[model samples]
Target: MTSADRSSDLSRAGRLRLAVAQLNPVLGDVTGNLELARRARAEAAGQGADLVLFSELFLSGYPPEDLVLKPAFVAACREALDTLAGETADGGPGVLVGLPWREGDKLHNAVALLDAGRVVGVRFKVDLPNYGEFDEKRVFQPGPLPGPLGFRGLRLGVPVCEDSWNDEVCECLAETGAEILLVPNGSPFHAGKPEVRLQVMVQRVVETDLPLVYCNQVGGQDELVFDGASFALQADRSLAFQMGEFCEEIAVSDWRRDGETWICESGPRVALPDTDSARWQACVLGFRDYVEKNRFPGVVLGLSGGIDSAVVAAMAVDALGAERVHCVMLPYRYTSDESLADAQGCVDALGLRYDIVSIAPAVEGFTECLGPLFAGTHAGVTEENLQSRARGTILMAISNKFGAMVATTGNKSEMSVGYATLYGDMNGGFNPIKDLYKTQVYRLAAWRNANRPEALKGPDGIVIPENIITKVPTAELRENQTDQDSLPEYDVLDDILECLVENEMSVGEIEARGHDRELIHRIEHLLYIAEYKRRQSAPGVKITRKNFGRDRRYPITNRFRDRS
Candidate 1:
């Protein structure tokens, strides 16, 4: 018989069951995350799984960043892994767990295979992704190319997260007499990443001629949200199982002898959400996890009755429930009756705790205090900034008193072009819409009104009123201070921002899109000059491929503009 037949014969039994553990691991919580692993292993055993696989760096959590530099943190992870390994001494299902492994001078992103209460094998990630939201190469030293590990009677080819992104790792395993491939991942979600990941695996299956299983983590880590849409593909490239996205789940798959290779007999298949629903789910999950993980009792935000604030309030209600969400209407002299009514309508619809706090006293106090310094200067943008500062101060005070986190509400458009006040409206613990463009804010607002997913905690149907959607967007800090007074209309502005921020197009190229040359130049200047402001903005969910913080990094002091 050939190697394929020999590989097949190594399986002690005719049947093998595999379990995918899609779990959320708290960063640097070695003890807690170890318990999570133990629980997942127990659940997999309950499902009659012979093997349980977890996502990458599950013990230390994904992208531990600078924490890996601390020797104590790395030692804690190893100690916890040893504890978990010792527990496997019971005849339960084996575990393939990912963690940071320190071998002498080199630290590796590795996964340990445990059975019969001890680690049987360990595999390290060969590929370290360094582009776009990933800085693995900066933290982890890549391991040598790997071959398959023997488990029970099967030769299992296991590649850690980024290793399977390319063809080399999978090809090496296939050539070295591996019968199957299983990949553990901490892949975060972008708009179209799920579909892209499936195609990448399809190519792997085609090249290796072996079945493959993918297990990804779920929940938010900082601004990155990992949607656990784990799946498996048979040798023929047929989907065997698909776990749901954005939730924790333990799904199992059965494999049967198909000639010299094993093929998955099939498992659960959850339909993936559409792009809009997926984006909505990502934002909610990210927002919820950030609040819960950081130990915030609840959240508070100033509800100006604009689309951005309205959308954030709804998200807050969905994420933490209406009881935890506090909406304060910080109205000034320019605050329209329509706006006040709209804000109240939102509070009533979402069942939120509502309060109307006039900023008249606070603004007047500031004006009086600064009157001497501003005696000769005309009343302009500086005074307009006072209104926002007053609102921010009030909301922050409320947060402090109630032990709630302040949730700022600023969309990508405002954030990209310095349309926000630094210590004023931009003052919050987090912003749910920080990465969402103005048009996307409008789009998701309408989408939320139309459909409420089962996953969200908030109530359904028209949570955002029609008037909020139809109203002209404004800051309401001054009389008739619509956003367009200083910027282009939202549709035009959003397109230009996307081109510059996401696409990184030049002004000439943006102008080629039929925009005026001067306008493109002006928007570019705004985008560049606003870097300092963005540096100080609150963290938010990253829905787009390139978000403001981790993905896009520009020099704040650079004078170079896109002259081309």
Candidate 2:
């Protein structure tokens, strides 16, 4: 008899209890990831799971990227996989785990099925995704079209992520007698991505006529954030189970075969948050993970009493507790009384530590040092920028002394245009609201004020003062200087920016949308010239399909402008 037949305790009795581990794992830490796998497998065993399914690259962590190219790293992953597979000798739950598998000379994104103290089968991913924020083909070679793996007495189709997204892989598996499809994903979150995943999975189910289980990883990795909204769908394309998003949970479900088809007997079905709620949770989760993973003691940011900083401050309090978020107000000669009051109101609501440091000393010192250099120049943008640089320097000093990360708070609208100063207010380790446009920042601020979700760490009801949102946004560098003094209004600016950055629309196309043509040209020019600033900007969580870092890569020395 084969190993599958010889294992007495391992039998397919037309019913199976499968557990899905929606977990967060740190990349490049194979030892930690292995331990995580061990704990999760043990937990699933305690819950009486027949088999446990983990997300893609659960051992080495997903998107190991260029790390897979290193022979030593690939070897470490293989060793960990073998150790994990050996643990199944306890006759506990079987594990369908993902890892980087190195064969002879080829390395692939692969998953192995383990049971009865041995690896029963191994399958490599067929389709390697190479789109936005994904470049699997760059690091690992693609495997050939695959068939089903016979586990116990049932035939199982295991399609790793992108395999199920295309019809060829699933179609091949189904034609070769696969019973059910289990998809392992390391899918990251973008606005509307959850719905996009559902539609894609539904289409695969419809095409293959097989029940599918999608298990996704949950956590923040650099600029990307994964939401573990794992679920199962029956052959009829009906929802079998729906797990919660932005939280880690090992959910178990019972599945029974109905003639030739399998259906989930029972599993969790939860109400997902709307767009605004999901976006907030994503930001909080991303920010929290970045801080904790990097081992920052806390975070510090300038609370300028503007919507952007207020929103970022509230998010910081939500991600890290109030005790860990430090807000400093750097006042100068042009500082407004209303701004000071608003900043105080925000700190009181969030209940975080607040301090006021005057930038007059730093600014005056710099002016004295540069008096000869600026003998013939007017006190225009340069003088105003000195104020911002002073604040940036002060925040950086606090960060260096207290071991807290500086949280830069610049929205996409400011970054897209050259409105923000480099090494000045743009100084930070990370920006929580970098991907959000100015209008979206206002919207999220309003959302946070009205409702505090259960997942956040901040307090509820008016964490951001209403005046902060209603008032005109400004750098407060000069007397009565507002953002509109140089650029258009935020509402108009954000709309135009979205068209240019996200939509990549031409000047004429933007003008067709009721904006002036010359304005579009000017905005387009600003967007191109600001590429260097964005290149030096801090990374943030990606909420949109095209964020500044990975999604949009433009040349810094380009001269082509779309006059069409």
Candidate 3:
């Protein structure tokens, strides 16, 4: 039937059963994603749903990245959508799914509405996000303001992800006779991002006086973690339903025509997790998806007994079950007995496989080889780096032998100031706490020890030793080495880095915040100088507005510093 025919049929007032599939999609896994969508549709059908709604690019997966550029990949996504459309012949429930589409010479991020074995309508995203990790402008073309899609006798306004963040798209849909707004999003989780999303949607609702269903994709896509906190906002600004965060769900919301408008009646209303719990879940989900989606057998990491490594090990255990996590203590001559005990304590607490490998032989061999070259110079950072490199090598060798991915444990504070060794401790397939500040790392460790989420795979109650959390953090490359010896204390360092990295505050602006000018300048210089190191670092979960790799991109060769 024609779209006009469908619109005319929808003129009669009735109730519509809408299913929101808050699912996790693996990027570039078109077949897997298709299967996922098919299962969700079946589930919705069984639940007596009139329509199934999926997050943005549910078939191709959200933020397919550069994979969308490949015509073959786009073609595969289109084929999958067509196959899904054909399945609608059963007339169980229509499907509204997002995918990358190509028409003529333009590639657009589009959503297709399928009903009765045919694509009723397709709407393209208008506001292609470009800043802060989004590169939609770099890829797909921005489409014109779209009208609502005709679905089952109703004008369902479909806004793909970023379009609903603004007024123009939803406004146009409302003006064009859209009764209810369904926004499919690939919104990633950052600290307090849910509130931001709600505020944006609230503004749109207030403007258009339309009840909106905000469906977000859940799961980890590399550095990005989509918190599937999907919900419906009524015209009166009341929440109709709220899906759980950091988990997959297919919730059905009932909508009934009210006088000339449609309003959400009732559905799932799961409570959103607190900020800390949400962030921790995001980290765990991101790590798990990275390892599993990439087909890694498991993960391996060096358990230094330090807060950073201990927390990472806990996250690893939580992400992949304790059996899949291998914790190795790579000790050198300067490695402390306390560190050894703490490492063992953590492993025992988490019930993961533990190993102790001495790095003395490798460190001695490296020193012996480079002894002549360094004969005239005093031992310093280079020597300390050798120890880290030795440990990193041992972890990589373990990874190679066991087919386990390495989890780098460096936090944002260390990464910002180049405190981490490039090829040494930085060697890993992924870093779960890459964007968390050292202070935040300690807080997360304590939080995890005190409370275990139902989703955690590891044993409950203080997996990280209290001593590990209380002790002064150190690399232990020297006799009494501490991180503060090379850089400022974490409390001060994180604040400065937050200003410089996240806020992009100038040196003077930072100084105005009660920090010394010299200290700010030094930190800024170090942050800029470490661009090359960060450029080579592994991708990690993004927990902040500005993360190292995707959110904040800096030139390695640039000499510009915010001296002002």
Candidate 4:
């Protein structure tokens, strides 16, 4: 008997060798990606895999963004698919891969099942998730459910990524003689998202009574990263083969038939950290991938000694050693001694290279230049933004000179409302804290300081000064510029943003939840007005359900208000 027949666990019912290849594909690199896919397939075949599944858009790339509009790019993707299909004819292993398929005028976000060097079957995505970071509907057309492909007398159904989320695809396949369901996904990572996936997959398995293999893509793409964390759910809703999260791995598991149905027996359970811990690790990974993949030498950012920048600096140090992280303290005329001391404390604690670049010179230059324009205007937040702009310009200059990318440190709370300066404090190549709310920032800071994870390379023991966290948050634009002076408390602000952004609750709905009406309105106005700033903002780890980029797209020129 094979290993599958000998296994007694319900999780291992059908013994079929399967391989999941977690890959990172560069956008628009058709040739490179196809070759990478072939290499992965060859590797899987070497491991004795009967079938290998790849992540979504593996032939092209996830979130090809506007490149899907290019006709030539689509044609190149199709040609690459043809090459992959031709390879399977070598009598190697069957392959399930994501690609953009063109059928006359309709282009589909599809997965092709290849066997014996020929295209055997194709499954199309049914559910087009447009909300949040997905714009699938805006690009490719949804495809019809594909029936099972008969191979070696075993009928297999392939649900291309989003199709597996709903029961229709799996149900249709099961009804059409599909004994097993294989899902190829390019699902992105968010805080607590994998659990949701697990719940959904388990439910699908229970409903279909068929063993399922959940294969996902890995690595950062633009502002998003797909955490592989691929897993297999047996017919009895038990986890069989669990792959590692937030990393690359070529995992192989055997599935076998038990009684009348097939199931995957336990091979290994890849333990995942807690939700918050995973978010922290994902943030670090996102930063590393964005910097290294883009070929940036290092990173630089303003060290305000606040939780936001402090946490970002810590992540940067963890991502690219302390040697690669450059911290700058841009103090202005109104900057307090405590802030300065706190900034220094973080620098000293982390042992990173830092410099105190006073913004007085540039601030004075800008004030003198705009002297006539602001001659009669009362100097208020405009002056504070001037200080921020000065600091931003200085950091950008240093970045340009030293060939290091700037890491912006704005959290979701600041980005929710128009609290951040557009081209000023918002300047950076990446923002590690963009998805984290202010509360989350503080919590993560404390968590990192107290218990350092393996991903964190910085020194321990309060890398973010206590004074920075305890002190009232202030931009220090003017003499006494507290964040509360311009916005609501973080506790209140994050709640409103979550209701508005994630839950899609309107202003009235949020106000009904016991928040002040005027406060909600003000926050709403700030969020709507800040689209332009977010558009130009740096890419960051997407930990929340709805991040500023990709997830939420508001018109910068719209006049519509959420009065309801």
Off by over 4 Å in 4: 1-14, 85-91, 455-462, 506-512, 557-564
Candidate 1, residues 1-564, lDDT tens digits: the string is 433343354375668888899999999899999999999888888887888999999999988998998999999999998999899777677889988899889999999988767888999899999998999888889999998988777889998888888999999999998898999999999899999999999999999999999999999988999999999999999998999999999998899976778888869999999988898889899999999999999999999888999999999988889999988998889999999999989998999998889999999999999999989999999999999988889988998899999999999999999999988999999888898999998999999999988878999888999999998888877778888899999899999999998998888888899999888889899999999999999999999999999999999998888887
Lowest lDDT block of 10, candidate 3: 1-10
Q: Which ten residues in a row have the lowest lDDT in candidate 1?
A: 1-10
In candidate 2, which residue pairs clash?
Answer: none
TM-score of each: 0.97, 0.98, 0.98, 0.91
Residue-wise C-alpha lDDT for candidate 3, range 193-238, written one tens digit per residue: 9999999999999999999999999999889999899999988889
Where is model 1 more than 4 Å wrong at Cα? Answer: 1-10
Model 4 over residues 1-564: C-alpha lDDT tens digits?
332332232233245778889778877889999889888888988987877888888888897766878899989998998888898766667788888877889878888778766787787777777767888899888777668866555778888777888899899889898888888888999988789999999888888888888888888887897888888888778887888888788888877776668766545588987877788888988898899888999999999877788888888988889999999999887788988888888888888899998899898998899999888899887887888888889999999999999999999999878788978999988988898999999888777777766656777677777877788998878777788987888999999999988898988889888999988888888888888888888888888887877777778987777876
Could you tell me which residue pairs clash in candidate 3?
Answer: 10-153
Residue 110, candidate 4: Cα error in Å is 2.1
